[model samples]
Target: MGQAGATFPQSLWDPSFLFLTSGTSEGGSREGLWGHVDQLNRTLAQHTEDIAHLRDDLLDCRAQLAEQLEKNLLFPQISTSLLSVALMYMEAQRKPDPEKAIAGGTGD
Candidate 1:
Protein backbone atom coordinates (compact mmCIF):
# COMPACT_ATOMS: atom_id res chain seq x y z
CA MET A 1 0.00 0.00 0.00
CA GLY A 2 3.02 2.26 0.48
CA GLN A 3 5.83 3.12 -1.97
CA ALA A 4 4.46 0.68 -4.61
CA GLY A 5 5.21 -2.46 -2.54
CA ALA A 6 5.54 -1.66 1.19
CA THR A 7 3.03 -3.11 3.65
CA PHE A 8 2.09 0.20 5.38
CA PRO A 9 -0.89 2.34 4.43
CA GLN A 10 -0.13 4.96 1.76
CA SER A 11 -1.64 7.76 3.87
CA LEU A 12 1.24 7.52 6.38
CA TRP A 13 3.62 8.81 3.69
CA ASP A 14 1.82 12.20 3.59
CA PRO A 15 1.75 13.98 6.93
CA SER A 16 -1.36 15.94 5.98
CA PHE A 17 -3.28 12.70 5.48
CA LEU A 18 -1.57 10.75 8.31
CA PHE A 19 -3.74 9.14 10.96
CA LEU A 20 -2.43 6.96 13.76
CA THR A 21 -3.46 3.45 12.78
CA SER A 22 -3.85 0.88 15.60
CA GLY A 23 -1.10 -1.21 14.02
CA THR A 24 1.37 1.70 14.20
CA SER A 25 1.02 2.42 17.95
CA GLU A 26 0.64 0.02 20.83
CA GLY A 27 2.26 2.50 23.22
CA GLY A 28 2.58 5.58 20.96
CA SER A 29 6.03 5.61 19.31
CA ARG A 30 7.21 8.21 16.68
CA GLU A 31 10.04 6.27 15.00
CA GLY A 32 7.81 4.58 12.43
CA LEU A 33 6.29 7.90 11.45
CA TRP A 34 9.75 9.39 10.85
CA GLY A 35 10.73 6.54 8.52
CA HIS A 36 7.61 7.01 6.40
CA VAL A 37 8.32 10.75 6.21
CA ASP A 38 11.86 10.04 4.95
CA GLN A 39 10.60 7.73 2.23
CA LEU A 40 8.03 10.27 1.11
CA ASN A 41 10.70 12.97 0.95
CA ARG A 42 12.84 10.81 -1.35
CA THR A 43 9.86 10.08 -3.60
CA LEU A 44 9.03 13.79 -3.95
CA ALA A 45 12.64 14.70 -4.78
CA GLN A 46 12.70 12.13 -7.61
CA HIS A 47 9.44 13.55 -8.97
CA THR A 48 10.97 17.05 -9.19
CA GLU A 49 13.78 15.74 -11.36
CA ASP A 50 11.29 14.00 -13.66
CA ILE A 51 9.32 17.25 -14.01
CA ALA A 52 12.46 19.15 -15.05
CA HIS A 53 13.23 16.62 -17.77
CA LEU A 54 9.69 16.94 -19.12
CA ARG A 55 10.01 20.72 -19.18
CA ASP A 56 13.17 20.49 -21.30
CA ASP A 57 11.43 18.14 -23.75
CA LEU A 58 8.45 20.48 -24.12
CA LEU A 59 10.68 23.49 -24.76
CA ASP A 60 12.53 21.61 -27.50
CA CYS A 61 9.23 20.74 -29.17
CA ARG A 62 8.11 24.38 -29.05
CA ALA A 63 11.28 25.54 -30.81
CA GLN A 64 10.89 22.93 -33.55
CA LEU A 65 7.25 23.94 -34.11
CA ALA A 66 8.20 27.61 -34.46
CA GLU A 67 10.82 26.76 -37.09
CA GLN A 68 8.27 24.72 -39.07
CA LEU A 69 5.67 27.50 -38.88
CA GLU A 70 8.14 30.03 -40.32
CA LYS A 71 8.83 27.73 -43.27
CA ASN A 72 5.10 27.21 -43.85
CA LEU A 73 4.51 30.98 -43.96
CA LEU A 74 7.34 31.52 -46.49
CA PHE A 75 6.50 28.70 -48.93
CA PRO A 76 3.63 30.49 -50.71
CA GLN A 77 5.68 33.59 -51.56
CA ILE A 78 8.56 31.46 -52.92
CA SER A 79 6.19 29.44 -55.11
CA THR A 80 4.55 32.60 -56.51
CA SER A 81 7.93 34.14 -57.44
CA LEU A 82 9.07 30.93 -59.17
CA LEU A 83 5.81 30.72 -61.16
CA SER A 84 6.15 34.36 -62.31
CA VAL A 85 9.66 33.69 -63.66
CA ALA A 86 8.51 30.56 -65.51
CA LEU A 87 5.58 32.42 -67.16
CA MET A 88 7.86 35.25 -68.26
CA TYR A 89 10.26 32.74 -69.90
CA MET A 90 7.39 31.05 -71.77
CA GLU A 91 6.12 34.44 -73.09
CA ALA A 92 9.60 35.38 -74.30
CA GLN A 93 9.94 32.05 -76.17
CA ARG A 94 6.62 32.65 -77.97
CA LYS A 95 7.67 36.10 -79.37
CA PRO A 96 9.88 36.40 -82.51
CA ASP A 97 12.98 38.67 -82.46
CA PRO A 98 12.19 42.23 -83.64
CA GLU A 99 15.10 42.33 -86.18
CA LYS A 100 14.30 38.89 -87.68
CA ALA A 101 10.56 39.60 -88.00
CA ILE A 102 11.17 43.01 -89.68
CA ALA A 103 13.75 41.65 -92.16
CA GLY A 104 11.48 38.70 -93.12
CA GLY A 105 8.51 41.08 -93.69
CA THR A 106 8.22 42.96 -96.99
CA GLY A 107 8.23 46.78 -96.85
CA ASP A 108 4.61 47.05 -95.59
Candidate 2:
Protein backbone atom coordinates (compact mmCIF):
# COMPACT_ATOMS: atom_id res chain seq x y z
CA MET A 1 0.00 0.00 0.00
CA GLY A 2 2.79 2.38 -0.91
CA GLN A 3 1.70 4.14 -4.10
CA ALA A 4 3.05 7.59 -3.41
CA GLY A 5 3.09 9.11 -6.89
CA ALA A 6 -0.47 10.37 -7.07
CA THR A 7 -1.19 13.49 -9.09
CA PHE A 8 -3.79 16.28 -8.98
CA PRO A 9 -5.14 18.00 -12.10
CA GLN A 10 -4.11 21.44 -13.41
CA SER A 11 -7.60 22.87 -12.96
CA LEU A 12 -6.89 23.10 -9.25
CA TRP A 13 -4.29 25.78 -10.02
CA ASP A 14 -6.20 27.51 -12.84
CA PRO A 15 -5.74 31.28 -12.53
CA SER A 16 -9.15 32.07 -13.97
CA PHE A 17 -10.80 30.45 -10.96
CA LEU A 18 -9.28 33.12 -8.69
CA PHE A 19 -10.09 36.77 -8.01
CA LEU A 20 -9.19 39.71 -5.79
CA THR A 21 -11.81 40.98 -3.36
CA SER A 22 -11.53 43.78 -0.83
CA GLY A 23 -13.10 41.54 1.82
CA THR A 24 -12.49 37.90 2.67
CA SER A 25 -14.78 35.37 0.96
CA GLU A 26 -15.73 33.99 4.37
CA GLY A 27 -19.38 34.43 3.38
CA GLY A 28 -18.95 31.63 0.88
CA SER A 29 -17.34 29.52 3.59
CA ARG A 30 -20.44 30.15 5.71
CA GLU A 31 -22.77 28.23 3.36
CA GLY A 32 -23.96 31.41 1.60
CA LEU A 33 -22.10 31.40 -1.76
CA TRP A 34 -25.12 30.44 -3.83
CA GLY A 35 -27.32 32.72 -1.75
CA HIS A 36 -25.20 35.75 -2.63
CA VAL A 37 -24.15 34.54 -6.09
CA ASP A 38 -27.36 35.87 -7.59
CA GLN A 39 -26.59 39.34 -6.29
CA LEU A 40 -23.86 39.61 -8.94
CA ASN A 41 -26.21 38.62 -11.75
CA ARG A 42 -27.35 42.20 -12.28
CA THR A 43 -24.13 44.18 -12.01
CA LEU A 44 -21.28 41.79 -12.66
CA ALA A 45 -23.32 39.37 -14.74
CA GLN A 46 -20.29 37.55 -16.13
CA HIS A 47 -18.88 36.94 -12.67
CA THR A 48 -22.01 34.99 -11.75
CA GLU A 49 -21.07 32.27 -14.24
CA ASP A 50 -17.40 32.53 -13.35
CA ILE A 51 -18.19 32.04 -9.68
CA ALA A 52 -20.39 29.05 -10.38
CA HIS A 53 -17.79 27.47 -12.63
CA LEU A 54 -15.07 28.04 -10.03
CA ARG A 55 -17.23 26.42 -7.37
CA ASP A 56 -17.67 23.36 -9.56
CA ASP A 57 -13.93 23.15 -10.17
CA LEU A 58 -13.17 23.49 -6.48
CA LEU A 59 -15.52 20.66 -5.59
CA ASP A 60 -14.00 18.52 -8.32
CA CYS A 61 -10.51 19.28 -7.04
CA ARG A 62 -11.46 18.20 -3.54
CA ALA A 63 -12.82 14.93 -4.88
CA GLN A 64 -9.65 14.33 -6.88
CA LEU A 65 -7.47 15.10 -3.86
CA ALA A 66 -9.37 12.55 -1.79
CA GLU A 67 -9.02 9.92 -4.48
CA GLN A 68 -5.30 10.61 -4.84
CA LEU A 69 -4.76 10.48 -1.11
CA GLU A 70 -6.34 7.03 -1.00
CA LYS A 71 -4.02 5.81 -3.74
CA ASN A 72 -0.99 7.30 -1.98
CA LEU A 73 -1.72 5.75 1.39
CA LEU A 74 1.17 4.47 3.49
CA PHE A 75 2.60 4.90 6.97
CA PRO A 76 1.47 8.19 8.57
CA GLN A 77 4.77 10.07 8.26
CA ILE A 78 5.53 8.72 4.80
CA SER A 79 2.05 9.56 3.52
CA THR A 80 2.32 13.07 4.85
CA SER A 81 5.59 13.61 3.00
CA LEU A 82 4.14 12.10 -0.18
CA LEU A 83 1.57 14.81 -0.67
CA SER A 84 1.68 18.55 0.03
CA VAL A 85 -1.05 20.89 -1.15
CA ALA A 86 -1.16 24.66 -1.20
CA LEU A 87 -4.28 26.74 -1.86
CA MET A 88 -3.69 30.36 -2.86
CA TYR A 89 -5.31 33.33 -4.58
CA MET A 90 -3.92 34.43 -7.95
CA GLU A 91 -3.82 38.18 -7.21
CA ALA A 92 -4.10 38.85 -10.95
CA GLN A 93 -3.77 42.61 -10.98
CA ARG A 94 -3.60 45.49 -8.53
CA LYS A 95 -6.37 47.70 -9.87
CA PRO A 96 -6.88 50.09 -6.99
CA ASP A 97 -9.71 52.61 -6.97
CA PRO A 98 -7.99 55.98 -7.53
CA GLU A 99 -10.90 57.98 -6.12
CA LYS A 100 -11.01 55.97 -2.91
CA ALA A 101 -7.24 56.07 -2.50
CA ILE A 102 -7.05 59.83 -3.00
CA ALA A 103 -9.99 60.57 -0.70
CA GLY A 104 -8.99 58.22 2.13
CA GLY A 105 -5.22 58.69 2.03
CA THR A 106 -4.95 60.70 5.23
CA GLY A 107 -7.06 58.72 7.72
CA ASP A 108 -6.13 55.65 9.69
Write one digit per residue (lDDT tens) for candidate 2, span 1-108.
245773322463543223211134731242254446566656587777789999999999999999888766655656555443211122224456677789985222
**Segments of candidate 2 deviating more than 4 angstroms:** 1-43, 74-108
User: What TM-scores do the predictions have?
Assistant: 0.54, 0.29
Global local distance difference test of model 2: 0.55
Candidate 2: C-alpha RMSD after superposition: 36.4
Error of 1 at 75 (Å): 2.1
Once fitted onto the true fold, the runs of candidate 1 whose alpha carbons sit more than 4 angstroms away are 1-28, 92-108
lDDT of each candidate versus the true structure: 0.73, 0.55
Candidate 1, residues 18-99: lDDT per residue as tens digits? Answer: 5443335542446666677789999999999999999999999999999999999889889999999998888776756677
